[model samples]
Target: MESNGTGGEANAPENLLGTSPGASSLRSRTESECSDKLARFVLPSMDGSPPKVLTLNEVGDVLKNIQNMELVHEIAINPEFKFEPYEPPENSLERRIKDIMHKAFWDVLRGQLNENPPCYDHAIQLLAEIKDCFPQIISQNNTRALQHINEILDIDVIKQQAEEGVLDFRAYANFVIHLMAKSCAPARDELVRQLTEIEDVVDTFKNILETMALMKLDMVNYLLDFARNDIMANSVEYEKKKFKEYLEYYKFGFPATENWLKNSCIHDANNKPCSPEQTISNAYMELMDWDESKEFPEVLSIDKERILKLGQRAKRLCTCAAVISICSGVPVISQRTENRVALAKQIDIILQGTTNEKELLDSIENVWLQVKTVINEYLQKEDQPVIDANTEDMLKSQIMQTGNKDSPVRTLMWKRFQTYFRLAMRSRAGLPPPPPGYADFKDELEAYCTALKRVIAYNHSVFGEYFMKVLTQQRVTSTDTTTSAAAAAASATESVEPVSSSAAAVTEEKSVNSQ
Candidate 1:
């Protein structure tokens, strides 16, 4: 019993066809039966048995037939789709799959125009079912898979496959080109190309996709710093305007924080007499590294006005830090001023302590802790609560009555009068210009600062006073509506102007007269 590897049926040729032994299978079997058998038996070869060999040529012809079925099915259904390989016993499966696919493509080229939706529908259904059962087809069948496929067919097998399917490969390709030209919208050109170049289509796509991904990553890396810079630039534009307004208001509060890392306190705390220029240089370097200088708001919501109040506050602290820098140096000139470094440390604490929501919250909190220590020891004598409460109340009142009452303006003027008067008092007695170093200046920057403070504080105070005065006058005028109402109104108007002017003049005079 010599087993001629023909496992189909021991008597397949004899039993199925009435004619005996060796009639050519391709010519004898009806195309439909061969196709049905191929789909039912050979195509779905998942059973663990080795497939019975038809004559090698016979098998090739059968595969070629199956390819036509697949394509006609695909076209009637997914006419646009190319057949992907199948799975299971990976290498063998792919070889069988590529044989069928190659024939189908050839058939499509050979003028098998399938416009019928039913065939298309069945092909779509069949391919989808096959795909579900065998998702790893191509991935499983790599280079070696192609070699195995070549073992089964002629290098020219694809050409014959196309010929038998009645396809003209070149004409089909040109037809595809014509169809793409006719397409009015973005079409699946790449997918068509993949199908046309079936053997290495997946490999090429993989490379293209990889290259595109790398390009995207490179672009993002290049733009990361720019994005960060844009954020900072926007912040600076907004913040600078606010700072300018704050400078106009002349309330210096937040100097320390903006340059904290520069002050040598963080880096060289034990060293005495740090050079101011050197300290500034070091801090500037640190600032250059920050990606957020432009990101701070131009005006902070300190009480509600869009004054660069946050920056002003920071500037104040910076100045205090500057004073520390000066003091830290003072130990060299006067042994008595050896304690200035410590005093500088105290100033750092005070400046760090004052803060609000938009302030760099953590830094402010940390600085405040230092300030608290200083306050606990040295500033114990000053009535911090009283001064703070007074300033806060005055500021709030000025804001509330900004346009509502001219009295708010008058109250500000009166406050200015008081500030100039105090400075004048300080100057007439010649009492060392408020400690540290207020003496060395021709523009009289200190006097100007003092005058500006007077102006702001006066605006705050006089407004409150005049608001109350007008309120009283209104009550009196309402009840006693005759002559006193007009007189009181006239007096209030005359008094407000003279007062604000006199106050401003006094402030300027004190500025000059004191210096």
Candidate 2:
């Protein structure tokens, strides 16, 4: 074949730019640029090629790495044979298949969790993705899977995970639901039931999942959702550039998979299959179904903005609540008390370098160490006379008056205080507020406030009677300045013009005579 100048063939300089038309130099430069691009674009596929062909022994080693997922096994055993032969199943067969798949999936997850609770995070994630893609398969696969799914539902494992005060299952489940809606449809009943269960759990983890998901989703959608419905829209505005580029890619028909995993910060390029890192990333990516690219957009600019907002809000609320808790006569320690102040200072020391994202997420426990010191300080005052008196009175008058020892208000008060105190310390740096109506986050605020109040109350009950005595004495010495002002006003009125009332007096006398 005759060689074209496309490959690295030496061109005759006389026939190239040297002897061509006026724009020949430009054309030559363009060709050179094109060649450079081709060199970068079409290298040997060392990095991108498929796995090398395995020898018989190597294949056995590979098979050993395969996870024996029960759900996968159950699906493989489907008698409907539609997946293999592409036959349409009858309604009964479809239903049976889905039922079996769902049960098997949950059973596998439960087995995984029981085998190792640490793996529950990975197991929940896989189950959710499987449910999302093959909802139909899950629906009609097998009845056995439903029983296991019900067992998870029965033990309220997901809820327990949340109640245990973590986000492992809840986050996994949420991401799954998100993937399902954006990628495929989940079974209507199953989705609804799981969502309802989620609603009953802690909102903090829910907020975390949703907030993190929105961050992964991008800020433009978040802003657009907010603009369209200001009342219900709740997302931070970090990563707008990244999000905007992502939107552009979407418009250009790019898939959403790789970007989602990339934004989540969980993707691992080195592992595959059963490794949670790979499984989680692949599951979400499969839902999104997009190819990876190096020239993708950067929608990550809003991270600091949202984190700042959340951090500042948390801090201000804690300050206000700390003050109010101290003033409410609820028997709490003063936040500024020497020991408490010292602890706050320690928090300030940590806060000097920490990020709002860290504080809002409460991933840093050192913040809580200072808070615990304050709590311990308050607890030590329980034996003091004033505290003893108040406790005794509270037990006798209020506690005895109620049929139940724990009233909702009191229970919530204590719980709310604990939450608030924890939050105050955990997020001393602050977090951005969620979208509106999300104001119910005040429940969390209330909880945080209550903890501070408890600390204050404990201290005040010990030392508050003396403080109240000092205040009463000060009040006794203070003059009734308002009453004095009123008397002076009356005297001034008497000294002013007397003739103004003459017409009024005549009218009054005439009225009396007529009566």
Candidate 3:
């Protein structure tokens, strides 16, 4: 959450904005945008002002995270998610000014009351302002509380009491505090107690107002949470309906999905006919090894971040497995505690530091030192120098070979994982076990499997029909083209001498078939 100098916190009061992406902007709009006091104010701005500035990142985070969320569903799923209170940085100019202004305001009121007969002017305004806060805290449905509050703090009635010399300003503050205790969240019970600790009328009123600001936020969050819970409870189906409508309006116009699936089909080392099941699995794999410049298929936007992270983690696993294979070749260590395995894992970390291939290639030059450092650290722990000068050269030479795309260890491990993934995509009752040499990466592979299954299952639920139609259409086109080409070749192989106009007709027929 980015904090500006204005003392605002990002993603404030979830209910202030609509739960869906199409909903207009958030925290709360000013009176210019909304007319009703309650409608205009769900949660007060960070400075208790009319409008709050939500940063770009904050807005993006809110929209992206809630883009597919059914607010009702989110609340149902986790009603306990806390909405943090906004507080300006203590050293910020806004906080300093607020503190100064609040103190000065309280001081004037205190000074007025300390005068010859106690002016009561500022006190009356403060009471009126405090009176307005009742609607902010208590629900409109709680008419009993609202009616009682209105009668007790009515400015007209208070003025009469002041003229009659019977108005108790301190009593009104105490009454507001008592009402606040009943209105606040269970979490704020301690704040009500602290307000009681301040005996000075001015000090008590000052803290009471500040505490009310906080309690208002708590009430807003609580209300927001309640609304969101009901929203989330039914959000899943609502989201599906919205997504279907979105697709239908565009005619499920997913050229990106088509391109992604087609590209995955062509990824064989040898140009062979790709199966549809394998194509889907390969497409998922492509997302993992996806090029950064290319946009992800829009249909998978919900799982975009998850797939990317999973891909990176999966890559790290494969690379580590390969490194383990490479490490065994170097004559660098004692056979006691699996030092080669430790070295491999550490080396994979360096190699997978970033997604940038060039960066990793550049860093490959220093991998030897890293490898040495890791081994030396382990060796020192065991009271031995596992890598000496000769061993360092051998380990560095073998380790650096991993930078080559064709390195035997790298190729072997990658191919094994790919085959395992392809097999994992199968739906048949009995299937082949994962390829050998994956035990070292079993945990990562399992995690990848779980994440991939979730994406595949949900995506298929939403898009299975479209994918099937597209794939079936593509298959039919390929078959017709292949059959036409084969028939053309077969006819061309036969002798067809020109035997007059009849031969001309035959030749024309052949030409049509060939074309």
RMSD (CA, Å), each prediction: 34.8, 32.3, 11.8
Candidate 3 wrongly placed segments (more than 4 Å): 1-239, 266-275, 324-355, 358-370, 380-383, 400-408, 420-445, 480-515
Model 2, range 1-515, lDDT digits (tens) per residue?
01232222123221111221231211123335445322221111223453233232332222222211211222222222122222336677877787687667656655655553344554445445344333332333556754544554433466466446553555555644553344322333353334534563233234333333333344333333344433112111211222333222122211232233334333247631133343333332222112223322112111223223433444433332332232223344443355444444454455444333334234224443444444445656655333455543443343222212143333433344334344443464553342221232355555434433333333233323333443343334333554687899998879764765887898999999999
For candidate 3, the per-residue lDDT at 474 reads 82
Q: In model 1, where do residues sit more than 4 Å from their true spots? A: 1-361, 364-432, 435-451, 457-515
Provide the clashing-pair count of each candidate structure: 40, 54, 9
| Candidate 1 per-residue lDDT over residues 1-515, each given as its tens digit | 01323345433322211221232233234446445243222211223444343344554343333333322322322212333333446468777887688566535523333433112222223223322322122223355643443343222443444445543334433332343223212333454344345443223323333333333343343444345445333433333333333223222222233224224323356633344444433332332123243322111112122223432442333344333333233223124343444555454454454444234333433343443344334434444332245543443343233212134343443343334334543463432343233222212334434433332332233223323343344446544774677889888989798888999999999999989
Question: For model 3, what is the alpha-carbon lDDT of residue 370?
Answer: 73
Best by TM-score: 3
Deviation from native of the Cα of residue 26 in model 1, angstroms: 94
Model 3 lDDT per residue over 1-515, tens place: 23312224333323322122232343455555433332322212333345434444444444344344433333443436556777779899999998899888888998988887667888999988888987988888999999999988999988888777777988988898899988888887898878888889898988888888887787788788667746654555665665554432123245666777776675356755688876776676676566768857766665566678767666666666666665555444435336765665566667667564555556666766776676677668868767677877876776676666467776887788777776776645533454555555566576676567556655665566667677778888988998999998777655343345677898899999999
For model 3, which pairs clash?
A: 71-232, 72-231, 72-232, 72-233, 73-231, 73-232, 73-233, 74-232, 75-229
**Reference-based TM-score of each model:** 0.17, 0.17, 0.55
